[model samples]
Target: MRTRPRGDAGQAFPIYIMMVAGLLFLALAFFAVGKASALRNDSQGAADAAALAAAQKARANFGLGFLNSLRANALDAFLIAPFAPPCAEAQRLANANEADTNSCTPTSGYLRDLITVAVEGRDPVDSPVLPGSEDKVAKAKATALIEFRCPNPKVIDADSNGYPEAFIFTCLSGDVVTIATADIERPGLWESVSRTLFDVRLVDQ
Candidate 1:
């Protein structure tokens, strides 16, 4: 019978141990990457929801008879600034998604109809897949836009039908105009046309 030398004894055991350790390291790295990817997705989702909420509020703005261009009370919407309600809406939505809102800024593009939202996801301290992610936070940004399709108010008619078509107002300066219902040829059937408002869903940026 041949006996194994002392120096060579259990050498196979060390190699096996090393292989197992390497496998475990690879598995941990894969898990960490997966966890981080999931967190990043969550952050982006939260940002989108926040931005959409804010934009919806701004889209609700509208002006009624003799208000947009004519002088009237505050029961109307102003295109000059629509920041506060939308910002508050964004904050509420971000909180619901377990994210903290960093900023809600109104951006330039299409005049003042764009809103941008930034949020940070809560750190996953309890993550089993990525232990170190507890100290790392996920962040994302999104933009929501309001697109207006305004019908030319100057293209007036007696009613919905194009009758008594040509009408002009000296006081009106732009496409948006407000005039008395009596001024319309068919006062009883007259309808005021303003900027048609709608919102585009959030886009990750």
Candidate 2:
């Protein structure tokens, strides 16, 4: 039986170890990249939801305000709109999507009609794939917009003061109007004009 040199006995051991280490590193890198991507996607979803939520809230306010105008007809209440800060709605939506809101603000040049939101993923992952990256969290941003088109809104000028008091609306063909104090005394004289409300929705731009 021939005995190999002690030094050569394990010469291949180092190469094997190096190969294993390299493969392990590659795996870790892949895993880290995948984790980061997933977190990024989650963050993006959160941001989108948040922005949409804010826009939806504004839409609701717009509806209510227009309805009130149909009742009061004294002022264009929409000017004072956004009954609630859109950021609050965004925060709520971010939480639902397992993310925290980094920032929520209305887009410039758009009055309560557009919302933008930035968000971060909720939890930090302990990643061995990317050293020192474990502390980093995923972030994403989104924007949502709203617009309305009143095809043929009949502006109500009940007071004849040039300030519209209300708008007359009809879901299909029947007119719906709120009874005013004067309307109680004399029907159909001071009520809002019968017209179609604006078609409102979320827009990509």
Candidate 3:
């Protein structure tokens, strides 16, 4: 039996060890990057949900009594009118998604309202391969728009009381909702009608 040279075996062993170490380091680096990316995506989803929740909450809070007082043409102002920021809902939703709200702002536009939210992941990205990144948390931002879906809403003329008697909201989806002024007296009427008249969705920030 012939024996391999001891010097050659010593050299090859070191090379093999170096190669394995390099590969292991590369695998760990990739894993760290993937984890960071996943956390970022989760943060983004949380931000989106929070923003939409804030906008929807504002939409649901539209005062029916206020709407009843508006003129026929001015009724569309419901979306743009200044109202309380529904940031509490955003915070609640962000917490539910394992994130924290960084900021929540509401902006009013011509016929729409926008809720912008920023959030950070609850957990930090901790990886041995990424030095000083253990304290780094993922962050993301999102915007949600609340716009009226009814393009040509018809308002019935008011009676002697000068208050509009009814509203015929013809939504873009060909759905019609007729709301009598008297309906305002019923509880939960605005909550039910607002969903049909307004559309809440995520929009470009």
Candidate 4:
């Protein structure tokens, strides 16, 4: 039987190592992209849900009472509830060498802003210029921010040059919701107008 070339064995080891390294790199990239995408989706969904919740609450009562009520409820529901699980999950997934969950706390500032914007934009109404009109315009708005961390350090370059140069990825999005109601012509219209505005803002949030 013919013997294999003597030098081939030495060459084969480096090739194997290179192939394994390439595979690991690709895997890390895929994992990081997937994680970032998932987090982005989750954040956007949470924002939309929270906004809609605030808006719906405002719509029901059609006044400042509605917005105030929803704001109080949302303090517990949206801002705190959704984050608790992810905070724990982040800690569990963190590596010894990687930054701990403490780094994630800074992101809470964005969450607070998001919740505030959503609640504040809950209702805004435009009443008819003429008396005895049924045409009224209402509007609502909401915003949210999302951050994603990669499990593998290799995928993200902390010092990379780009718009967002940091290893971490952050995304922000805003949405507007609107509804209209009948306009009435009468005295003390401003009270009704203010109430409608509050309700509209709540609905949009």
User: Among these predicted structures, which one has the highest lDDT?
Assistant: 3
**Candidate 1: where is the Cα deviation over 4 Å?**
1-9, 61-67, 70-85, 108-112, 125-132, 155-196
Candidate 3 clashing pairs, residues 3+ apart or interchain: none
Tens-digit per-residue lDDT, 1-205, candidate 4: 9998999999999999999999987886666556445544444343344543333332332333322323233322332323322333333322221222222221233123222221111111222222322332122223323321111111132223321211211222222212121122233432533332322222122
Across residues 86-164, which tens digit of lDDT does each residue of candidate 3 receive? Answer: 9999999999999999999988875677889999998888999888898999999999998878766676987786667
> Which has the better TM-score: candidate 1, or candidate 4?
1
- Who is ahead in lDDT, 1 or 3? 3
Worst 10 residues of 3 by lDDT: 64-73
> Rank by lDDT, descending?
3, 2, 1, 4
Clash count for each candidate, listed in order shown:
0, 8, 0, 12
lDDT (C-alpha, whole model) for all candidates: 0.63, 0.63, 0.83, 0.32
Instruction: Please write out the lDDT profile of model 2 over residues 60-137, one tens digit for every residue.
Output: 555444545545643344543554447888899899989999887664332235677889987676687666786788
Clashes of 4: 12
How many clashes in candidate 1? 0
Q: Comparing candidate 2 with candidate 4, which one achieves the higher TM-score? A: 2
- Output the TM-score of candidate 4: 0.34
RMSD, one per candidate, in order? 7.6, 6.6, 2.1, 26.8
